[model samples]
Target chain A: MSTSLDDRLLALIDGGDDAEAIQQLQTDPAARQRYLDLVALQIMLHEKLEGDAAVVTPEQEAERLKFRALVWAGALAAMIALAVTAWFALTASDVNHKPVSVSHSIAMISDLSPDARFADATAMMNLGSELMAGPIHLTAGRAQVVFHSGTVVDLTGPCEFEMTGVNQASLKLGRLEAYVPPDAHGFTVQTPAGVKVVDLGTAYVLHVRQDDVSDVRVTEGRVLIQTDQEQRELAADEAARWRISPSGLASLEVTRTTARQVLIDFRGEASQGVNASERYNVFDPVGAWRFTSAFEGTRLFSNLHDVDGKPTGISLTSRMATTMAAGIAGELFVNPVDGFEYNATTDGVFIKGDPDQHHVIFHFDGLEPGGKYAFTFAVGLEANNQVAPKIALGASTQTLAPHDKTRVIAFDDIIADAQGRIDCTVTPASPGVCFITALRISYQALQPTQERMNP
Target chain B: MAGPREPEQFVQHLTAHQTRLRAFIHALMADWHRAEDVLQETNAVLWRKADQFEPGTNFHAWAFAIAHNQVRLARLRSARDRHHFDETLADQLASEAIEQFADLDHRRQALAICFDKLPKKQRELLARRYTANEPVTTIAKSLRRPAGSIRQTLYRIRTALADCIGRSMSREAGQ
Candidate 1:
């Protein structure tokens, strides 16, 4: 009675005095005025309380309700933030140049409709319809495929192969280099000779030619090669050829071989786990371009540099890159085919490539028309002081720098213009460590896209 | 009863109940977004647990129960840290008045539209005095204003909004 008319009515309803409710309803003028208006609410609340017996005082109910409201609000914001952070973290990991492992087999098919039954000995790649026994199989595409388990393969325009029987596989016509895992049960590439490759616990490449020549090269670890008639264990920086016609194995100097070099660097503190909280400033200090990662699952630092100690004119990508390299603990962060830029502290470099493919690209943009460039790549030597020389893929010889204690390699000078993309590859003489950090490249005139037609 | 009504029957029932339930939740939560979330969660729960409910037996009651629980849960989740709000009980009374009118879905919609059209200052006073459960003294203390001034302001706002609601209803009816 000391309350408002509304409160009193509510109190009556709460108390469950129905007989008194009707009498109280009849006497109060305000209650009579809103009699019909209160009917539905009365029925609903009455049923809600009496039917379920979940009756509660208003204070207690309000306290419980406010708690729920706050929790819902916080949870919603947290979920969105986590999603964004996860996306950027996945991308930053790729920029720092970490290796990726083959968590799933990427199967790609060359011809969606094919007549030939690719033989069991065909080297199946992550790029073709070889039907890999894993989560992701690249079904149809001519891709330089990299698996999460540090396996890189260049599946040509058409081929098929399967990963049958554990690590042992049968290749039809593809080329591949598998960073043999320590746990791998000696993967056998069954050619006509049934060569069993013992796990050297390192990275090696294998290629099958049209004339039945199986070219095997060891990049990092030692590889044991076997034929129906002969067996050989080749160390890193060595290669051997097995001819199907002669049915014999011949050891060859790896210097006579051809391959490409991929140079990448990181610019900031690498992501701790799967996400990054800080944004690193990574940019191609030389050109007008876009930034991209090499592949999915590969981790990279926030910085990358070309052989010419200059910004590659490419920033760290915002996508996960694939991991592919031999014995590399993590995944290699591959740059995208485009460009981007930002600012951050710089980290070291990561070198990764597909073993079978002979072409490594020195990806650069924003170059001058005629600029002098010089660079140095540090080389790590084995016990014998033998330098790991990479095969210069496109143009080989140039002026060498003063060799204080090592080889100062160089490249041919060329004019750069806007008419084409300035991309080249430098092959290493040996395989163990073919990378240089402190490099120099001079800048010259820039040919804009519009100037091409007018000039 | 037989397989708990086909998908088609369920869809039809949902279409019929969705608007009504939405309006009901909107009134209770006073937050459109929260209402929508509760509606979605309620609908999903209703679908999964539809088998437990007998067919043709007070569908609204069953649905309302689910919605009520969802609202309670949502409120608890949002206000876990703040056990009490400093709005007047009169504010709660005003919101309660609207809630009383909320059962009529059409009237509730019309009233909500009119409510939003009111000035922000007036709406705040109304919400504080009527919708929220704070006592007048508590509201005055929180606002750092005199209780008499707040009461006078509230009286003026109520009279104006009553007139606003009446005009808004007539306009909608004419339209």
Candidate 2:
């Protein structure tokens, strides 16, 4: 192995892939030893650095220093257990045998968005604070309520929510998203008019507006929504909507919509593909772009603007390595939305099929470092079952099929790369058929959602 | 089958090898936080299988076998985002890592002695990257340097640390 073994191993530890370095470690004896040495060094750094994160005050640091040798050898496990034994076994043998305070709190606050406001308190709830079953009203802000059973319910208020059980909750107003692990099976959510959404284990989103309407979209797994009129099972990517009119009657509608679209609709954003004749009515966009034919090889500005309607400095370059042989125009297509009749995308950048040609690549730059973002885009697939198209974002890849003729794909909580770069590639099943129709990106904070916090 | 061992003996063996078992998992999986969770799980299994451990046998080796199985099961259950080696590659690395991490404590001691000698700025950078689990690209952006340069700088510090550790270990062995 070479001297750059250090760099290679460093990169690998940092989540970079190098087949050659891995191969060397497998075949070379000296390299293997060096790699192991590096691993040991990493273990020490992790142990100490993480210990620093845990021991906060000077007293805690002093306590750690008293048994620093044990701490160095990953002794936290043995020491914490020993400490409990030392304190309880010797002093309180009576209760040590078996007696303790019972906790009535069934859930904990996992995350709260920056602007999250609870109706009980006009400020943020501390992350990991335990909650007892009662009403949870949020005047504004988004919060993730995590049940001890491993289910997480994300709520966006002005929402009137009541925690009825460890596995049950009522969404009387605003929006609720439930992410249930298989162990958290039978998790249920109730809406107004006594409609119950019993989840069989899925990641789903729901919206309840003030106008007596509640919409639920199942993004990954199946969702069971039981209404007064009917009980329906919504499969992946299917949506269920309940509307109650002032006549005090409830109505149900089953439709097809992505989680992204339902969220957009709930926010009262302009509907995408709602009117074929009316131009540019899109879902909520921090940035929106259309690959006009005139936008060939030239950089075009996005319709993204601030509250004052100034540009947000987000744009797209229409250079796809293989530019459509000069003077070729964008292609127009009809995008079928289950309930909307007049849904179509105007002219989009069309690519001529070349089997060996590289798929379309777009590098989104000039983003704030460490920001979490979600983006949704539309693709026009000409055939129902030609081949599955692949989309690669960073190192993660997903193969998806068109929903009818047009597919709107959205990915959430994608952490921007160190260079603040988001590279997207759309690979067509057939060479000449793939078309880029539209795309939008939104910024979101992930610390509230992604980071694991203990109270 | 589970066999018989003293509870104190089992706890002693398990805790002593916690750090090494962690290193073995890191060899197969790239995510450090996930590795810690696997280590905890492995410790639980080791406790349950305490009686299965034959007396006079090498405890680290036995513990490594159980830890390897836990890592295998975990990777199989992981969701998208967490990274791991394939089954075949992980198996190969597991054996090698189990063998290599036997003397891990000594290497770790040497690493500490050498790591403390690094400049304050370099140490802080390392803490930011590994402790805070920040990415090199973000660090690069903050430093106003190219991401490649930040990576190279890290590589140099790590290489120097490794060299110092190797020499320290050799000096102690000679004495």
Candidate 3:
């Protein structure tokens, strides 16, 4: 309950009738003291509106946030937190979205997670380690990069990221979850695709793929996403993907969910290589395909239906690869025209390169609607990986290493369509000697109709 | 030597207490311009009563007491004036303000911190209202909002500021 005089006081201050308020102040000592306190506060506010607010951080905790909020020339108040060293190389930029040539260090790696493993290039960045305005490639684990502008970025590897400015960074590849406080409203993350995401005091996660495609999801507050072509605002729980194709830069808003975290791990290099392949069946799949050059028997094993032609839980309805019939080990192997037919004991399957665009589209049906799936596969080739095939699931794509054959990549968050279908695609195929093998699809049902499955 | 330094010391004391003296007068008698007149009159009395002031005494308390007497005499002289207040109320206001003389600095500093916590728009509006001295009606018209809304926003801002300052003071005390 308010002291009824507060209304009278507010009304009195606004040129309303002050007789009641003045009478109350005259009689009640408490009212008089409160009136004086309010009046004093008013006088001070009038004096402080244009001045600086010196936030005095007590001497108790050195790790706690402590900074002086200084009003800059305009509405933008530039705040620098001393949590990191403020050694600004301080060269001015051209004021364009082009990458700033940073001469001095403006940020430091504040902390590393328990399992964080920095790449050999980033080996020197421990706690309180300063970062030059350049690429920080982490082969494994997570790190927290604290900028002098009070923007903190929690980065997970295998990622290539760079600190571009005191309040700015560029996510070239990998995942970064940024926390931009109000004092650091203009904290920016520039993707390799020339898309700049400027924070309006927000916490957001950005993932940059190998194909210059950046996906940004705002978890709190708002952000301004700008490219040379267009600009848009992304609010909380909203997500958009930016891609720089041959045409130009393009952005697409996607259906955002809690799957963003899983996608970050999917973007990481947490691979289950050949050594871990024996344990790959830890999560049972509706169907597992192992493609090989050798044909054990003329048995046609289809994913369409079982004995009674009922719809299977998961079925590869259609697939396409540019026609190729190779005589491997004295047996004729032809690419699938509409369906993949293989023997029960076949080692692997051949995914052909499309003649026109080299894009292999696989429309897998009978999935649980809105269900998240983990599609893990390995590339088995007698020759070196010249194809370097990429697997595309919705807004994310991962490319295989040319020298690595043991590494199995898992796309952990491919959401199925409402019609229980996944329109997955494989792209930019090179004609060499390779086939996708040990391809498995498994997921705990994301809907009520399904049961949770564990690996 | 003490007699020679008396006028200089008195002038320094009067000069330093000018703003606080005016505010103290304003606290007693609501009209700020009238408080100004009373503050000038109080300054003259302090100058005339300079020889009576003991050196190293609480200058604000001594000066504020003189200012309170001047406010009482001014109110007695201006019986027909609109803002003339009750004498008992005036005495209480003067005593309380003098007692809080030490805390005024801390409250003012705390206000700086509290002001920054206000939303940017509210802070700008408050700054414009006080520093630029813009009226609420004009602000409402310019902002394309109702005068009542503007008044309500201003009230809310003031309330937040007052509460924030109180919290800051309490936290400081605890620390």
Fraction of true contacts retained by every candidate, in order, equals 0.00, 0.34, 0.17
lDDT of 1 by residue, A368-421 (tens): 333433233333222222323352313443322322222334453444545322
TM-score of each: 0.27, 0.37, 0.33
User: Model 3 misses residue A291 by how many Å?
Assistant: 99
- Clashing pairs for model 2 are A116-A141, A353-A431, A353-A432, B3-B51, B3-B52, B4-B51
Mind sharing the TM-score for model 3?
0.33
| Segments in model 3 whose C-alpha atoms lie over 4 Å from true places | A1-4, A13-16, A46-455, B1-19
A96-155: candidate 2 lDDT, tens digit per residue? 123222446666676665566877773336665667677789886667787666677877
lDDT of 3 by residue, A131-245 (tens): 7787788876678887766678888777888776667778878888888777677888877656888898898888888876778878789878777756777766567776778
Instruction: Kindly report which residue pairs in candidate 3 clash with one another.
Output: A290-A347, A290-A348, A291-A347, A291-A348, A291-A349, A292-A348, A292-A349, A322-A353
Docking tier of model 2: it is incorrect
If you assessed candidate 1 against the hidden native complex, which CAPRI class would it receive?
Answer: incorrect
Task: Supply every candidate's count of residue pairs whose N, Cα or C atoms clash at under 3 angstroms.
Answer: 121, 6, 8
Candidates ranked by DockQ: 2, 3, 1
